[model samples]
Target: MIDSGSTATRRISRTSLVVALALCLALAGCGDSVAPPSLPIGSHRAATHVVAPGETIYHIATEYGVSVGRLMAANGISDPRDLRVGQVLTIPGGDRGASIGTASSGVRRYTGARSSRQFQWPVQNGVVSSGFGIRNGAMHDGVDIAAPAGTPVYAADSGVVIFSGTLHGYGNTVIIRHDDDYATVYGHNERNLVSEGTRVARGQEISEIGRSGRTTGANLHFEVRRDNVAENPLAYLPDPASSDRISFAAAGGS
Candidate 1:
């Protein structure tokens, strides 16, 4: 038979042991890890994104609810196809509506007046990666047509080459003065085929597409100006749906 006092002591000791075990479990000292609770959706958004393999600018733009042109402008990206894996892109603030004008069927519509003069396509089988508009709080004076390097750039209309050479942001640029104070510009060319003061006809090859002057990939920056004021090229060129239209991906891609 055990002593009564000794029996009480053993019971106390057992109770103390159970309490210690409970404390250990509560403190998570037994190697059982717990996952962190996830935050609510839209609670937080990163200001920058690291590009991953096979990630296109269009995909990122859609994911962030921003326009492709805005995203490119924010990052100084002239060509969407130039996006590389591991590249860091700055995420611009505001939604798609703030960055781009009203879009229909994923293409931004130019609400401004169209040009009265008609013009032909500058690059055949090219993709219009960026359109003329206000982007990143600044006006993008031209449309960027993505094409393979060395692709021929044609004259939009019959005119005389006014300027042919490097000009600031435009590399190997060729400017043609057309009738009625209208002009066309072809920029970011591998080489200028026409010299200044040379006459060129409509559809004449003027330059070759290249990734020169503030660009990361091969493309042609085409612009239409009247009285030195910028105008939307889409308004002057043939509709992309027409048979004579320059092949383009309205959704922005290579």
Candidate 2:
């Protein structure tokens, strides 16, 4: 027979071991529930994140516990769709944080080199249903080109597709970063034919028009940005009255 005192001691040891294991499991669960840590101001230099496949700007911002607008502004990205796989993004930290405003309030400024690139009309057989500038007490950052559903939308100029995805208010959008400080936006697409990082030439079909996002009917919402500032696309586009086809003599054409 076992010694009675020794048996009691062994029972107590087993009970203690079970309690210890339970405490460890509880601690591990708590750790998993803790929120992601924010980068402390001045704790370290800004970190860089390499874009991985299937990663979007929104996901990265969430992972870093930063606002999407701040992350975009820090990188001079005016359109959310401009994020691409394999791109290196600078994570804003310390006093390097940037403030970005809504479309109605305007956005952070970016001073890129002067661009002479001309833009071609993105939608064929479309009419300007709405122009850019203040409308209904808010800023209309881009023009609405009304077209029938399924109308092909072309790239305004040659550029690499920086972003192509769905965005709030803009719906399915495609943003192209051209030479110099210029970029173009095409929004309200029913479908996007090109993916991010693809090189597109002027007049190449990138999307099909649709009544996506905040729209009353089928149309393509288009904008031209220089140095990340929205400009009146009409000023850059060939006058519709001049020609139905591409105009080589548009004011800003080379």
Candidate 3:
């Protein structure tokens, strides 16, 4: 019982409704094929999101393109593993999960002090198989510490995890950045315990020694980088001591 003009108007309203819903979904990062937005460079608004089942801090930080440490800091989250299914977290991006927003913004800034700790030997027990510098007519960027296949790898120093993933032949790698602007890289790990951007302590377990990338046996490929240049790790590691038990484990693993 409607004219053609009225029917067209009704159709337009329906289309508008659908479009609005789609935009909302896009903002929430749900049901859309679009890649999650990266954090914008300019001013932005704050948004709140309830943690969903099976969501991890790493996943949320990557989705928003913000550092996991920053995200955790924003919400005052002390423990990343303690996230609840319905827990509310403050997403530190633009409003509605949008990466960018206009000049008018409403977001609170989180100001907290970082942890102050030094570095320690990453692997609990291992024998030095390879040292830094040129080897076999090629550059050896790191030291290879031979360990058991599943020996836990500790943090050489306290720092924030800048990376936790694969890197070509490095295998399951983890790179931690220390307060002194030095970074340590742990490669050929069986498993990475900490996610990128999470603050870690000295002597904390970060991964497990493994031959994940291009190693012939179980070992940890350790590297120390300062301002992005490779350096010698032995210069920093503690001198071999009886407490290390490196000799005991080396005998069995070797």
Best by TM-score: 1
Instruction: Give all TM-scores, in the order shown.
Output: 0.56, 0.52, 0.51
Per residue, candidate 3 scores C-alpha lDDT tens digits across 76-152 of: 77566777899888876535443311112211121122122224677776776654432222234556778888899
Query: Lowest summed lDDT over 10 consecutive residues: which window, candidate 3?
Result: 28-37
What CA RMSD would candidate 1 show?
A: 28.7
Which candidate number maximizes lDDT?
1
The sequence of per-residue lDDT tens digits that candidate 1 reaches over residues 1-254 is 11224646635533443332233223211101011112111222436888999888756765564434456767988666789999999876523222333112233434433445679889877877666543333344567788889999999999877678875456677888787667787878899999976889999999999977656578898877654544557778766665543554454421
lDDT of each: 0.61, 0.57, 0.56
Ten-residue region with minimum lDDT total, candidate 2: 27-36
- Where does model 1 exceed 4 Å of error? 1-114, 242-254
In candidate 1 the C-alpha lDDT for residue 94 amounts to 28
Error of 1 at 12 (Å): 99
Ordered by TM-score, highest first, the candidates read 1, 2, 3
Pairs of residues at least 3 apart in sequence or in different chains that clash in candidate 1: none
Question: Which digits, one per residue and each the tens of the lDDT, describe model 2 over residues 1-254?
Answer: 11234646635533442332233223211000111123422233466888898887656665554444446767887565678888989876522333222223321111222224457889778666554433222234456776788999999989877678876566687887776556788878999999976888889999999877657778787877654544556556655554573222101100
Query: In model 3, where do residues sit more than 4 Å from their true spots?
Result: 1-118, 247-254
Pick by lDDT: 1 or 2, better one: 1
